[model samples]
Structure formats: structure tokens, C-alpha cells
Target: MYSTRSSKILFFHITIISLFSFSIVKPIQAEPYGMAGCGLGSMVPVWKNDIGQVLAATTNVSFSSQTFGITSGTSNCTNDGIVKQKMAQEVFIAYNEGPLELETTKGSGERIRAMASLLGCPTHANELGKLMKEKHSYLFAKSNLENEFRSKEILVRLKSQIALDDSLKYICKN
Candidate 1:
């Protein structure tokens, strides 16, 4: 029973609120699945548009493919959570290279603590920092490499060192 003008205003308000809600939502990290979410549907090339998302969602729900994929680790799903954790660590190291380097050299800092937490040993941050301090030269030896490559190298060396140490090997998850 609404008039045309009121109906138009109501539609406008709804549209604006929907847009505002979407704007406040943070993007998913690492996973690039669009509006359709992760599944066989997300792998489809057409999922970039709204209509494509509807189709992709339909395909997902109709087949129950997303649930199957998630349960069985197929269709862009991974059962190995370690891979995501490692990726997060890599990103953290790459972004905080300078602070990490300084902390590693000094054998303690907020960055070192954060890194220890990322490596799954929050309580042993000091010990991890000390280890880094001991291996400062070895860990930072690849400084001549590009930034991305250098961070990767540092990660490899750090993990290797951690693996060698009895205490760290038992405690560290990564």
C-alpha cells in the first residue's frame, strides 16, 4: 500500500545500508574465493560477477559440493592447516623484516615475541630470541638476496635451527 515516492526511498535506504555493511567487512586472507565462497564453484571462471556468483552458489548448494570439498580436502580446500600457518609466518616475516632483524640481533623485542607466537611457542619467546641471537650471522647471511627471497631464506634457516635444538624441536609447531 506504499506510494511510489516512499517505496523508492525505502529501496534507496536498503541499498545504502547493504553497501555500508559490505564495506565494513574485512576481506578473507589468502583465500581468494569471491562471493560464492570456496568450493568447486569458486574454481569456475565465471564467478567474478554477481550473476556468476548466484550460479556458483547454486552449483555449490545443489551438489553439496562445498561440504564435500571441505570434509575431504578437495576442490580448493586443504586439510593441512600448517600450510596456512606457514604462509602467515612468511607474510609476517616479510612485512616486519627490519624489526625482526633488529630483535634477532638484540635477542628480544615485541617483534621477536610475535614471531615466537607465530611459530607456536608463545611462552618461549625469550628462548627463541636467544637462539636467533646466537645464529644471527647464519640467519641474516642471505641479506644480499632480494627482500622476499631474504625473508624466505631466513625462515628456512630459523626452522632448520629450531629443528636442531632439542628444546625448540619439541616445543615449536612450525
Candidate 2:
């Protein structure tokens, strides 16, 4: 039993309230990959090991040539000393050798860049390349050694969890 003017006023008030509420109700984003798997204490070494592997793979060099720790006991870099040393080796290779490999090199891991190039995803490969070329930080997800090289299946799951390109195009291809 409200008048037309009152009805219009009520509608305007409700619309304003709804817009305000929507503005405040933002979607919760998943934490970045760098923050997910590792802690501050473990960040430096893990990042280094990861960058090293990428560099070695890019240059077609054996992981052993770089003197990374590989204990017969476990597949993990359990010791802090080993982890730090491995990361240092990675830093050296990334800074010193990455450009040389790109200029005149043929390595198995170069296939990653080749495939990306074919897909016209050279930008993606370049970003990955820059990660090796630059310094490490907590925000640097690509340099996260363990997670970056995980099996494709696991990577898909992880990416989906973070809502990062949740498409299954790469997974279901026979």
C-alpha cells in the first residue's frame, strides 16, 4: 500500500545496498605457489636448486656436473647445507651459462622451449628464462624448484586449486 514515490525510493535504496555489498564480497584467491609448498627457512635453497635444474636441463648438462647433493638414502634435499650449496650452483649456472646455451647449444631440455615456440608461447618460455636470469624472492613462483618440475598431473591439480587456467586441455589429450 505504498505510493509510487515511496516505491521508487525503496527500490533505489535496495539497489544501492546490493551494489555496496557486492563490492565488499570479493572472491578469495588462492595463495601463490611460492608461498604454498615452502617456508621462509626453506625458500632460498629450494629456489636455488630449482633454478639450477632448469639451467642444467637447458644446457644439456648433467645435474651431477654441477655438484648438487644427491644422497643415496633419499630423493629429497634433506640437509640444509646441501640445499644451500645446490642453490649456489644453480645461481652460477643461471647467471654464467644460460645465455651461452641459448646462443650456441643443443640440449634435451631445450625441447621445452622448442615446444613452446611451436605453440607460439615463446613469451611463457621467456618468462621462465628470466626467472633463471634474475634474483630469487618469495614471490618468485617459477624458481620454486620442486613444484615447477612436478609431474603434469600434479601440476594440473595444483594450478586448478589456485584457479590458474583451470582448463583441462593439456591433460586429456591422448
Candidate of highest TM-score: 1
TM-score of 2: 0.18
Worst 10 residues of 2 by lDDT: 66-75
Instruction: Give lDDT tens digits, candidate 2, residues 45-137.
Output: 434456644543433233332222222213232335534433333333343333423422322245324323323344454443333233122
Backbone clashes under 3 angstroms, per model: 0, 0
Model 1: number of backbone collisions: 0
| TM-scores for every candidate against the unseen true structure | 0.54, 0.18
Give candidate 1 misplaced runs (Cα > 4 Å): 1-83
Judge candidate 2 against the unseen true structure and give its global Cα lDDT, from 0 to 1. Answer: 0.36
Q: Least accurate stretch of 10 residues (summed lDDT) in model 1?
A: 79-88
List the pairs of residues colliding in candidate 1: none
